[model samples]
Target: MQIYWTKINKIIEETPEVKTFLLDCPEGYTWEEGAHIHLALEGFNAGDKPNRRLIRHMSISTLPNENSIGITTRIKEQCSEFKAILRNLDVGDEMAIFKTHSNVPLKREDKNVYLLSSGVGLATFRPLVLDYFERADNVNKIHSLNVDSSKDFLFTNIFESAPDKKFASQFVDNRKDYYEEVKNLAADKDGLFYVVGSDEFLVQNIEVLLEQGIKPDQIMLDKHARQLPEFLSSDLSI
Candidate 1:
């Protein structure tokens, strides 16, 4: 695989525990909305084999037209070794990115789109929203529902109710309310449902969506093809 080394342009603190690292876009590096990259720390390639702890698969929160590649994530006090190292890195620090791919790209099939996410998982949907706003030719409308118990919502500027723009967004702080909203959104059986969150969160949403009579094909997930059948199984019966 071709690896591209890039420098950090700046960092934006989106919330107390969340930050967006804006990296310099390398020449000839282009990716679609909802793309993710394997970010490797400085010491990742020191030995013959890469250090697993130094690499992380992060979503590209910004679009290629945005001029910078943004990786937005939450860093807690007791976080993983990779996040700890990442939090300490300063501007101009070089990092390696490779194996770029997108599991969830904007699918404009002339139908409504619903984005369901938990906390920082919304980072994966940022670009898709932006893409829709830029030119929503085949899309009908877009609605975003994010559950961040922190209450400090991210990207409030981008995610707002705009009738003219054909977009609306809502934030819920609790699971009970979030799932209720999910059920409500699932009423539109023909709408495309894109979900991003922890495995538990994904399973919970999938269960609720399936129970609501939404088909497996109408739901979009970041999981690979090999891993999708397990999630769509009857074992997730709620």
Candidate 2:
């Protein structure tokens, strides 16, 4: 993947710990929903070995509107270089951006679409929601369930305002209501289901859905990181 330099235009804290980043992509660049861009720090100072830090992948959280790409990051207590770079980034300062890629192409025309996401996983669904609302001929009804770990929920306002009845439910797992909320959504028939989240979130919810009689073929699971177990991989592939 080719990495290009992008400048951070602004950063806003959506929740206490989650922050949204607005980046100024180079002219003519565009991306689709569920696509991700890899970010890296710039300008390593003396004795600052090139921080070949793990490639941080962030979903294209918002649509490409007004020539900017939006990404949301969850701040961790360990204080990583990735977080540091994001924290210190200023307008006109450059950060690297690899072009977007995804494991599955979005099927916007699916009449009954079920979108499942947790925490930063909601980032992956942002563009999809935007696309669904933007088209004149789009006929799909979107059911989006967002799970957050109590303190780190992002963009609650956006999800709450979605016009579709199916898209309005948001889940906060701190109280254990996540499963029930997802169960209700999965009970619907003939919907194309897409799940994006941590491995545990995907696995547990997919299991719940299957237990509730959702066919395996109708569900698509995308893990945010590479820590997924083999059993889950096999299940997703089935």
Candidate 3:
């Protein structure tokens, strides 16, 4: 892992709680589509350490050819302090990135892929979804199921290129049925299942997928901001 520093170039608010930060990709700095980088704030406090550099893992939102590193994050009440620091950052503000790391290969096997995301989990998978259409060959039916509590969907226009395929469900009429709906989405069960979401989302759906007879290797995970449940709370390192 290598450390890199870059200044903020632009910030765009996609939703009230979600924002995307653009950073000038450093010289010779490169990363994969679904790669992730860590952000560290200088004066963040953790325990009694005033100089504690609070760090968080964020997914790279934009494609590699976009010329800049884009980070999209949601400011929740729990991490308000850290998100507030990032939210108030303006253009030219200094940002420290520890490194970009992703072992996910860029190869595919002509199998249908189901991108499953809930809430801010969309941050990690959006770039992968974009990469799928842009890079992979023999790509089969790519389905995206994005669920949010209210009708305020995050990436409404981002995935609009495929009108019939991408499905965004604002759980208003079907407020509490998103989980069940996910099961329905998995019915066809074609190829790879790339699951990105909170711990609860991973634990619940992964169990369902496994019970549905999907192999462990066929399920890929991009667990952001978590460790234990991120790994299924099992011995599985992935």
Candidate 4:
């Protein structure tokens, strides 16, 4: 696979535990909204096989036209080794990106789109929202629901409600309210649901959506095809 090394342009701390690393987009590197890449640390390519510990699957939080590649993530006090190393890296530090792909590209079907996420998982949908606002041709409307227990919501500037833009955004801090809103959104069975978060989060969202009559095909996830059956089997009986 072709690997492109790029330097960090800047870092924006969205919250105490969340950060957005803006990397210099390499020439000829282009991706659609909701794309993700394998971000490798400095020594990832030193050995024959890539070191799994040094590599992370991160969402490309920016669209191609935005000029910079954004990797937004949360690094709490007790995090993994990869995230700890990432948090210490300063601007101008170089990292390699490869195996870029997107499973949740914007699907404009003249239907309202709902984005449900937890904490920093909303980073995966930043580009999708931007893409819809920039060119909302096929989409009818867009609504975003994010639950961050920290209450220090990220991307508030971009997630604001815009009647003219036919977009709305809501932030909640608790799971009880978050699921209530999800159920309300799921009432619109024709709407498209895009979910991003931990496996548990995805399963919870899928279960709620399915229980509310949303079909498996109507929901979109950031997981791979091989990993989807597990999440999509929420309605199946053992």
Candidate 5:
């Protein structure tokens, strides 16, 4: 599918380091719960050959029924050159948006779904939480965890306001002491786990989950990395 330019409807400052862009899609593009779309600025870094056109894959955080698609991103000045472009985006600015991509499509099963995310990783797992809660049967079976610094706990209200909010857990790991709780959570062994986060974060969580007897087939992952070993790789539509 060809990439198209869409207008930016709004920019939400969730925290000092996190921003969510609400994009206007007149074509009515629809995507699955954990899907993501590529975004690029037209002619970003025009003259620089090596970095002239870099498209970033951003997860669609909003539910499919929403009027607009949204991408919540964490801004790190040292790691991204395109952040300047994103931060400067205005309400009416047009950005290049590619088609949606996802390998971990939403599926219902007898087993419960447990989602684990960290920092901006919430972008990928958020829609799943919202969609699952809409189903009366899934109300008590779904659980979630968000690990981040105390100040970086963005979008707390969204999960806290859910009908069965007790299933949602937010553990602030300011000192990296969250391992014990993480290990205990995954010991259920029968739960299906969906993980999204940085490479180190994903590795640590997956290792702990596996050590606690979770099978490889019971887990799905989307880590922020350019490449991973085939053993650790899953079908990432992005």
Candidate 6:
């Protein structure tokens, strides 16, 4: 992987616990939709040792435009390094980034596209969504389902106004039945589905989709955690 030093341009808080960082990339740097880059955090205190933290597999949260790119991250703990570094990041500070890469090819000419995401999984789908909006003759139908644990949903206005067939957001609390709500939503359409989230999140939703009659081939999932046994079942084979 090729590494480059980029400057942090700006950081915006999308929610109470989430922030989006805008980076100024080097001239002529380009990346495709769904690609991910690595960020190296050195000189950070990791327990007793002065260690380096490398965050690979971070998704590009926006299109590279005017020599800049964006990444959105969620704050896990109050004292976490990820939160500390991001909160204190400045405009001129330099950060190391590896070249972008992805196994998924997001170039779809189909008029219908469904984007389903939870938490920071939206970052993986941001570039593709932006490209669809930027094209001059783009008349494709885009449907986005953003699932969150509460009412403070991220990017609500942006996705609501985004050009598409439909846009919806569902907030689930642990006390509520999340599976039933998601199952009802997934049954509304039979189109290309892109699912991204934690492994448990993906597994639960994917099973709900399949139980509701969505074909395995029609559903594509990208999760941060390792694959679960449910996802590895033979029934998923085409």
Best by TM-score: 1
RMSD value for candidate 3: 4.3
What is the model-wide C-alpha lDDT for candidate 4? 0.93
lDDT of 3 by residue, 1-238 (tens): 5667789899988888788899998898888767888876654433575343367888888887888888888876567567778877899987778757863433377777777777767767767777765665766666667777745676666665464543232332242476676667667566677777776777777887766656666677764335435455444433
Q: List the candidate 5 regions with Cα displacement exceeding 4 Å.
A: 44-53, 77-79, 136-140, 161-166, 223-238
Instruction: Give lDDT: candidate 2, residue 168.
Output: 58
- The 0-to-1 C-alpha lDDT of every candidate, in the order given, reads 0.94, 0.70, 0.69, 0.93, 0.72, 0.66
Cα lDDT of model 1 by residue, 147-210, tens digit: 9999999999998889898999999999999999999999998999999999999999999999
Question: Tens digits of per-residue lDDT for model 2 on 6-80?
Answer: 788887778777788888877778877677877666753224454556358777787777467888888776688
Per-residue accuracy of model 5 over 1-238 as CA lDDT, tens digit each:
7767889999999988889999886585778888888887867436645244467878889886887888899876665667877888899998887757775555576676777878788778778777776663533466677778745786776666443443555655552656666676787778888778876777777677777777767777763333344325432211
Instruction: Name the regions of candidate 2 deviating beyond 4 angstroms.
Output: 43-51, 136-138, 161-166, 223-238
Score candidate 4 by TM-score against the native: 0.97
Clashing residue pairs found in predicted model 1: none
lDDT of 4 by residue, 1-238 (tens): 8999999999999989999999998999999899999999999879998899999999999988879999999999999999999999999999999999999999989999999999988999999999998899999999999999999999999999999999999999999999999999999989999999998898888888988999998999998889888778654422
Ranking by lDDT: 1, 4, 5, 2, 3, 6
Model 6 misses residue 120 by how many Å? Answer: 2.2
- What would you estimate as the lDDT of candidate 2? 0.70
What local lDDT score does residue 161 receive in model 4, on the 0 to 100 scale? 92
What local lDDT does model 3 show for residue 173? 24
> Lowest-scoring 10 consecutive residues by lDDT in candidate 2?
223-232
* Best model per lDDT: 1
Model 2 TM-score is 0.82
All candidates' TM-scores?
0.97, 0.82, 0.82, 0.97, 0.85, 0.78
Clashing pairs in 4: none
After TM-score superposition, the amount by which residue 95's alpha carbon in candidate 4 deviates from its true location, in angstroms, is 0.4
